[model samples]
Target: MRESSSSFPPHNNTSNAIHKFWNTIKCCSSSSTSASFLFISLFICTLFFTQWSHYIYFPHSTSTTNSLQFSNWTTLSNNNISHDYPKKDGYVLNCSSSKALTITCPPNYPPSNRNHKNFPSNQTCPDYFRWIHEDLKPWKKEGITREMVESLKEKAHFRLVIVNGTAYVKEYMKAYQTRDVFTYWGVLQVLKLYPGALPDLDLVFQCHDKPSIMKKQYRGWRAFVFGSRDPPPQFHYCGGDSTFDIVFPDWSFWGWPEVNVKPWVPLEKDLAEGNTMKNWTSREPFAFWKGNLRNGPRPKLAKCNSVNKWNAQIIDQDWIKESREGFKDSDLSKQCVHRYKIYMEGNAWSVSEKYILACDSMSLLIDPKYYDFFTRSLVPMKHYWPVNTMRLCKSINFAINWGNNNTKKAQEIGKEGSKYIFEQIKIENVYDYMFHVLNEYAKLLKYKPTIPEGAVELCSDRFACSPMGLETTYKIETMVNGPSEQGPCELPPSYEPLTLKSIHDQNAKIKEQVLAWEKENYGWSWWTWW
Candidate 1:
């Protein structure tokens, strides 16, 4: 199970962390090991003075912005607005029957239906979006019915309905920490970014880290399934081929305030700048991995935290201590000083994958069972060097040695990986993925989507920019500035059966090549170290 960030201090006071950063730099200088510290300290100091205030912790979040511009999403009142769905686990909102929540918004916000941009005729979406069709393919023969969606009510944490491009949401249960809240905020931002693209649709979205639906459950279900229905198409944060749920980008894209990690837009820009301050040749040579090693392959990774044994530096994260320290040591921008960084799963696919790849360091990606929205498109050698599961330390050790020996090749891989992330998965692509995934899912709905009786309509300004919680603070920092200057890229068509098979085969062959190289270079069972 994914661990909760509850141990963290509710508020992240990073805006006032200059003193802590001083202590961190002093400690680094005293340690006197890697010159990478020199670069990081200088880089941190520069960003601290210039970019820090824009991201300063806003205790009363609404104080930061003065403009109150908003889209045309006034809730349409109905006599039945206050009623609830009689169903056991389900409730939702219809776009037409909007009942706005009583949250405060800046009274003078501007109208949304202005300055809308058009999609460029030359642009195409990244390859990962093709899976939207694959994910909904099970219901292709028999289009998804309302009964299948209603049956999932028991497992859903919340229900979301989008009608005429406005969002209405109903909460059934609380997800771990603020997953449900931020996930909802993320969806709202998508609507704000692309005002009227998402079609009318209803979905039962669960925020849990794992997939609840299994294909075997609805193995032989007829299109007419209601009670004890087949594992219907469910939307969740993540999944693997082993499970049948649809995967979207996890909530960290907006921000993970519990960990004091900023949202992707600012964090991505900051990390990109940090990557520029130091070159590959001027970094710490050992492969680095740090996090809460409480589950999955992380604890075993701790064994490789030795210079001579694994040529890797693995640090166990103490979240409580970091939180108490005002998250000085937990800054994502400060951690990219190493030449090679490791990506390992913690019970599931880690959100750190994007941060790691963005560092322009040779990313040593270990085998993972689950994948998020973009990891599937990652080419083994081009984006990252695949680390094997067996003899874990030995594998990591060999990767570090090989990278150090082949600096240019390793650096190119790092650049390509970083380029893919920055160029392909920009904030626009993220919104596009959300747009197409929901748009395709809406195509499969056999019944007209409706606003659940008790649903609350959400707009980015009122719901996301509320100026109250930590989630809101992060949202304020990263919310869309205006309607996107361009429309979403045109998504590529689905892969043919053989084409999909070839892609998988090609990836598998690349991994096999790495394993084969290890065997050829180092004889079997060569335990020469004392």
Candidate 2:
């Protein structure tokens, strides 16, 4: 209006400028929409990238991690291989579980019942030579029975797999040669009992005492069995564990091989063939115990002889060769001469329990705090008498008095214990138990049996190879000649019961502390609150 343009009217110029301003605003709004779209696209791409990275980094697994420390081991199966087969990983393992590991006993064998009181009163030994000779057909042909294959159809199928890792075989050979005669024969007897089954890739047999505590070092494929049983402390294995899962009771616990060459023999024959002559009435009316007093409560029990009477005779017996007059010191066969026999714990579980019970004498058990594979199954007062160790001497005396007063009842208890042992704990039963355990352990393997690195080969057949190497032979000779000695045990100063005064004193101290604390807090209550 102040300066008019010549080209067009002033109103026309104003209209054009307004149109330009409106277009500029529309362009700005479109730019803002594009910016929001860009941000949203970037966020989605980042989220996908993060998710993909997480998926790639984490491990996908379904098996329980607690069973073993390491996992993701691969298992490969070979269908064509037969018995004496080498592990797929190239390690040589002997008879392993052909199937999955199970807790039940083998075919036709009955699971032991602890509560069953009525057992066979007169079970006798089978023909031992015939049993082995017909079955194993070992190189020693003297015992061989020329029985046809049809004869073995009734028995369970068994395989003898000897896992021979260089180091493991060396360790096994060492134990086999150095262990007691019972251990040596007992281990070999398993092989002797069963005909060799074709070795399956899934099976493996490890030769070592695989204590539960050593599970950390164990690989999942290996199974361990031994001549002794010590269940893990406060831990029970229902089916399988980290190390070896199956623990059959030691065969030596039933009978020792040095005592009898035959693999299968009755408990009566194993202990003393003449034991039947000395029944409860014919035996002396006294409690008898003869064992080493080096460890456990043996020394205390020996000291209790001070409280002895005509009814009990507990003597300290150092069982070493030097302590004995000849090859026979206390003839074990003569042990049944006494009406009552005592059961005591030694370094671990004693091997004498079965032999003692087989004597048909009332076993005055020293209230065992530890148990082997089957000891806990025996009922107290039914199979044997329990003696509380708090007043050890008094308990023993009381048990003996009860036995003397109740002769018929005591004899019944003795016979019942003998019956239980005979029915449940034969060598045949031992082999059956082993077969089940091995079968169960095979199923738990994470991989097919493989030879460990640096391990040596062990022959599956005992007859094919020598029992010991030159070095081991030398070592055994040295051990035989060496002085027999036992390491000292950490024994308590006294086995006497705690007095009532001690208990009262502990309670009084607790009461005094409480009273003092109350007095101190209550004394300054008002001032402290302020």
Candidate 3:
């Protein structure tokens, strides 16, 4: 009975143990499922936190990403947010209105029309380019004065600023503070200085030949004036001498016989003799001339130590001959010298020519005319002039004080002074003389003319001239007329008109290419910065 009882107890124990093991397995499975759910929820929360941090730190990046995604959608139908949907960080939302996003037209758009409105409308008048006085004010700072303005107004025309040489107007205009200043033949300075005292001038016109616009504009005025010996073609239309109330030929001692009065009067003498001598000195006839004339025999060679005398006649001729022979015949030494030097012509021509040549160093002398002629070169030397001429010439190396030209005594003094200059001045030391001359010229600008009691009448409006009409009339005749045996003068062909269809066709092709670029680059958004 004990054995049977023990066996039954063992069986009951085994059954109970099996039941506990099954219960343990069920509990383990339940714990594992709960842990898996918690881990997944934590991972989702961490991802959302990371995305929110990126949105807060970099709003532009997040907004750009959202815009790209939105643009990909075919239809804008979804309205509500869902839990499964990718959440948009609130900080990354765009707050700008639709109107703000749209491009607004710039105030300065359609630049062509804006420029047209601002530009002067009347092109006929002298003041057309400058409808208001403000436009002319900038020129005033350069040297133009109120008196000049008034003179231009009284003249009722634009002023003439003739440039006889290859001078850059922009450079000269900047150096002086007056628009009245011109770069014409330096001899013209004498004539310009006379009428320069007058005001009422507007623009300063310059050209190789006078334009037709000058004549048309001059008709509206009372008279015209000119300093040049060459008269405008419209002089006949205006009644020749009567057409021009005043004529001041830009004459000097060293100018062409036609342009300048004779005697090559010294500057000091002209100053002392006053306006009577300055204005009334009529040109001497070639028949009665006592001094050297071009038609007369060439000057003889005399003894001189100046190297310019020898070099001018020999070296210069050789160099010129070589230059004519072309590059093959040119000696290396001579070529090097020429490259460093320039040829200067000084005589009875324009002083502007001297200024132009003197702009560079190493200028050689072609001839010797007057002492003032030497003043124009910044590096003048005796080597510039012909040997024979310089040796025989007394005027080549002297400074004449013409203010005391009482008699032949003054002439003797000039001769002695010239000899002294030749003896003392060396080619290497010529720069000193150049500096002295430049300084004196610069100092002359400070000098104001002390207008004598009767001088005011000389610069009156009666003598003032119109630049536009003077130019226009000249252009009509000179340009339209064909070339003569004297020279070639012709007008350019007329301009052709453009058609609307051609312009439209060109514009269409341009627009197509522009549109193609825009489509590839997301339209006009690229120009947002501009």
Residue 409 accuracy (lDDT) in model 3: 41
lDDT of 1 by residue, 229-303 (tens): 446777987888877898877788887766677778778888998897788899998899888888776888988
Candidate 3, residues 14-114, lDDT tens digits: the string is 35545664565565545567777687557655544333221110001113122211010011111121112223221121223211212222232111111
Report the CA-based lDDT of candidate 2 relative to the real structure: 0.41
The full ranking of all candidates by lDDT, starting with the best, is 1, 2, 3
Candidate RMSDs in order:
15.7, 31.6, 39.5
CA-lDDT, candidates in order: 0.72, 0.41, 0.23
lDDT of each residue in 161-198, candidate 2, tens digit only = 24321101111112221122223233333332332321
Model 2 residue 182 CA deviation (Å) reads 5.8
Model 3, poorest ten-residue lDDT window?
1-10
Give me the candidate number with maximum TM-score: 1
Give the better candidate number (1 or 2) by TM-score. 1
Q: How many clashes in each candidate? A: 8, 15, 40
Runs of candidate 2 with Cα error greater than 4 angstroms are 1-177, 180-188, 196-246, 251-267, 270-272, 321-325, 453-530
Better of 1 and 2 by lDDT: 1
